[model samples]
Target: MNILGILRDGTGKMAVGASVAAFVAATCLAALPARADDVTWTMATHAGGHWLEHGAQGFADKVALYTEGRVKINVAQPGALGSPLTTTQTVKDGIAEAATTWGGHVQGIDKTGAIVGGWPGGLRPEEWFFWVYEDGGLDLIKQWRMEKFGVVSIPCDTGETEIFLHSHKPVRTIEDFKGLRVRTSGAWAEIAAKLGASTVVIPGDEAFSALERGVVDALEWAGPGQNFKSAFHTIAKYIITPGVHYASGLTECIINKDAWDKLSEHDKVMVEVAGRLNLYESYARYGELDIAGWAKLKEAAASGNNEFIKLDDSFIAAAQKASNDWADEQAGNNEWFKKVLESQRATLDKLETWDEFRLPIGGVRE
Candidate 1:
């Protein structure tokens, strides 16, 4: 009745889905272990709501099917293990076997981690996939994690939602940013700061309350898709964008190095297969639903529930220039910053055609 035996009895064999052969090569170094019974682990996220309900559940389901239930992961959304910041530590210290963590959310430990999620004008999904999966970006991130945190990361899922300003009052131009307190994160906050807004890093949960209490006059949360999910639309009437940012937010399904090592070859393969499938599925799913979300936003705007605002050409130019300059400044001191930016840019160049075709895949083709 040991866990491994239960796992093996539960999931008799490991099977790959349609895509595993294309991405990973089987190796004797990490061979399948003798089945004992069962293997169970916990997966944690910051938002245990719809995002994980649909997105992370896709990973959980595949693990169950691919491993035949031998390897079962109980999915926890909404900081079940702890805050997003603590999830990094939880996985590393084996407090939780696996977790969904974002780089920006853990600046207390590694300030650079947030850069993977979104940058001012960073890579889109196609370029991001090529850079991380094909162009050694994933390897580099793994090395960085090992060097700094002792956690092993798998690219779980990623999708871009437009970064826009939701404000109590209409903010139509750069001038409107002046003296306003706005909620933002990482480089976007710096971009807002450069444009004259004072930026605060509030947890996503507090954003609405901050706006309601006038703690922040505006906020650039995710696109209409997530804003609706988070219910920010109920508080803020103006949703403005110069298409200023997009979050190809990476959620790492990281496992403790030791626990990862203990996984049976069969279980390990199942994890990898599940990770890849989850990434593709979540990315594709977000791309699909977000289009409808935008349409819903437009309909709401028409009905006077919300106002969709766009940045003028001049404001976009100024914001882009400011963001680029800020990135350059950070690059001089942050080697990883330079490395990721260059890798992303180079990959974007190579996938110029893929980007062209992939645009419609995720309707955030700005």
Candidate 2:
């Protein structure tokens, strides 16, 4: 069925007659993958609510379109297939074909997971694009996951800068954090402790009650949009600024190795392409949602219910030092963590050269 070889050796013109054309079509059809490469996958996810649900659905839609319906992904909510913490494990164990997961949820299994999720003073969401697509980080993540965890990993979704904290007590300075009780998650709790804050983890379902009942003085969950969804603004008196804990965050889509192996090469690439498209698209759209949420938060501020508090700029340097020290400790603890850390920092250094030369656009952001 080597049609090209037969045509190359034919003693005739390159133009195909009707019989040859029909024969070539038949050969191509026969050469294709079995079932015409049609595949359907359940995309189990750790995220059930907020913009992430939309983002996951968008990824599924894109996969179908990019593969021309040869592949289909049906996204499932958290606990639909398994619990949030079990998402990656489900994919790894082949109990699920794929999952979109927050790496922060798996830090116990791999400390590097938290780094991938997001850490204080790390690369922003835009910076992640350079590191992943241009700086070979994608290949490294893929190789590491396949070798160590038996899954295909793609940097699939990103969230923008989050709220620093919703505080009952105003955090106007670094000192204000001293003895401040906060309910938070991920790497931020470690940094918060260094800032003299008492950090606690409360169940997400009870976070509102915790904040309302003075169980925790402050809470930091996500950006404005998600925070609004959780109604933190309704109770906390102070909305802190500059989410240094996580300037942004990354989440991955993982596929079972055996399930991925069943895909044709073209469809595999299409999935990756769909992931890349959704990564950028989801981040931007989420930011827009945050902007609208911020507007509503502003109205609440104007009504004398809550105050918008910007911590002194000096807190930035203190946070940066603490975050870097914690990151170094992580790098020293694991090889994969060390590699990704070096790659991200090195890429940021290179980008910093151009960033320093560019003129500011002259907004508050400058």
Candidate 3:
């Protein structure tokens, strides 16, 4: 028998085959087929930035390191695999193994899922993580995912909730909000309207162009992490800090039911562990990354071309009050909404107390 042919046919040919032929065959097998340990999974996200890249790619790196390179992940950014609108279905259909997408875009398929993931002024990262991991919010999010979206929702980072207002004109207070056309999405759009601002709901990719063309006077994207990539620094001369209107926002890593089912018990556990770890890291990193973005803002301001505004207590209180009222109204419209609100509030009370105690410098009211 030809040595090469024999090597190809036998499972244990490393002993009998010549070293060179065995190496060639091994290379061929490695490239052509996957062993039980050699698994490659693809994950998709809507936004492209160093922050997201690190959070996601960092997770993959840790997974490979932990699993000894047995499991690998390929990260796809910005509709590379599919639109956020279809990412849930894309993953469910096995078009992609996993995805990290904004909840609002998928609200049509699962409104409850979006609310639980992150509604405007929703669960803060610290509180949300405690509620999910220590309390019971994770199970609740998962239940809604299975029941409504037929996917697996892993609550990842709450990326800094610094909902900045980047606008052509300075917005010092609520009075400046009148007749201002702002670009927004999800429940926040309603908040904008109630504040007496006209809102244009456009795909995020089109936001910068719209802002540049003077289509919208104000734009409210999350933090400097995402805003920098959009280059809002160049066009929008003013940025308002401390997003009181939306206390929390969620960026979730979701997996197809079928794909999740294929993960072995141990592998599934690894994914869950890595997800939670990265989620924690993301919260910490948000401050660091946003600070870097702030440096850029400062540079622009120093040049006498732009300005950054810090929202006062009154502004934040007003935004939060409006948001709370909306949440209450939503609950009135849907019984399930009330249940979620109660679950979150109940969980928040416990987490906030524990967090305050843990930090010690902060006071806790119990």
Candidate 4:
């Protein structure tokens, strides 16, 4: 005992013993075998050559990186495996291991899907994120997917504000919407129908031909960049601003339940992280691309071939009123819809107070 005390106090033998123990533990850990199996998944998307598709590709790449190439994903362009409208079922039935789809497309399957996807006079992309991530929205989404579609859902991408109405005729007032044939979907379509406009549901790829053939007098399809990419300006001269109908659209990565369950815990987390990263990357990229698109539109406007019109405040107010009324009716009809809609509305009310007091960042242009 006297010799032990002397070594601890003067010889530093205790520190040497601790170091040796740490080395032994490290060596034992290093001797364990690593996970050796590699997994590759196939994912189908609802859109081809759009920013969302680009984001899907990014997710695949990032998943591989995060999983150290142990997990890989191959993304199929829109309609590759099945129609966009049927993608939810396709993923659920294991026709594809995964799918990237807008929530509205599956509303017919479950009304709750449209509310999560988007709603008229809805929260913007940033606000939607807070509701989904910070609030209990994500859990509700997962629950809904599991019960309704037998899949795991992750919000993977978000679109910017949609162009309210690309019209062949100028719509300057709420009254102007009467009898206006519009191509739209989800709640907006229902709201427009309530406001006396005839609404049609068509695939985005068919929008151009529909407009050209006079199948619809007006249509909404994404923001400036995507609208430009679709050459909407060439067909519809009046490009409406401030897309109130759909302020933002949320897209999701839907994975087959069995496939997702088969993934290791680490690989599952990597997939989730990749989805969130894609949301931010896609939003930022769309912002940059839209700026370039607006410049081109301005040039076209200078030649008197196109015009950007701001929807009248009164018209927007009326639309909001109709939207709220329709939402209430839907909530009345469906319990699950009511749960999600009320949650979102409550979140919006809480955010509105803070949003109103924030100072405007940039000056109004003359």
- Top-TM-score structure, candidate number: 4
Worst 10 residues of 4 by lDDT: 1-10
Pairs with steric clashes in candidate 2: none
In candidate 1, where is summed lDDT lowest over 10 consecutive residues? 1-10
Candidate 4: list runs displaced more than 4 Å.
1-34, 361-366
Q: Which RMSD values do the candidates have, in order?
A: 6.4, 8.6, 11.4, 10.5
Position 287, candidate 2: lDDT: 79
**Mind giving the per-residue lDDT tens digits that candidate 1 earns over 272-296?**
6677667767776777667777787
lDDT of 3 by residue, 1-366 (tens): 122232233464322224423443454334433336567889877666643576667677655654446678888876788775566777777888877766676655534544665666677666666566656677777787677678898765666775558889877677877899998877777777898889988767778899999999988876776777678978888887777655666777888887777666555655665565567667777767777877877787899988878867776677778877887887786665677777888876666567555655336768
Per-residue error (Å), model 2, residue 360: 4.4
Off by over 4 Å in 2: 1-35, 202-206, 356-366
Model 3 regions more than 4 Å off: 1-37, 312-314, 351-366
Model 2: per-residue Cα lDDT at residue 361: 39
When 1 and 3 are scored with TM-score, the better candidate is 1
Each model's C-alpha lDDT? 0.70, 0.77, 0.69, 0.78
Best-fitting candidate, measured by lDDT? 4
Lowest-sum lDDT 10-residue window in model 3:
1-10
* Global Cα lDDT for candidate 4: 0.78
Q: What would you estimate as the lDDT of candidate 3?
A: 0.69
Stretches of candidate 1 off by over 4 Å are 1-34, 353-366
Better of 3 and 4 by lDDT: 4
Instruction: List the lowest-lDDT window of 10 residues for candidate 2.
Output: 1-10
Compute the lDDT for candidate 1.
0.70
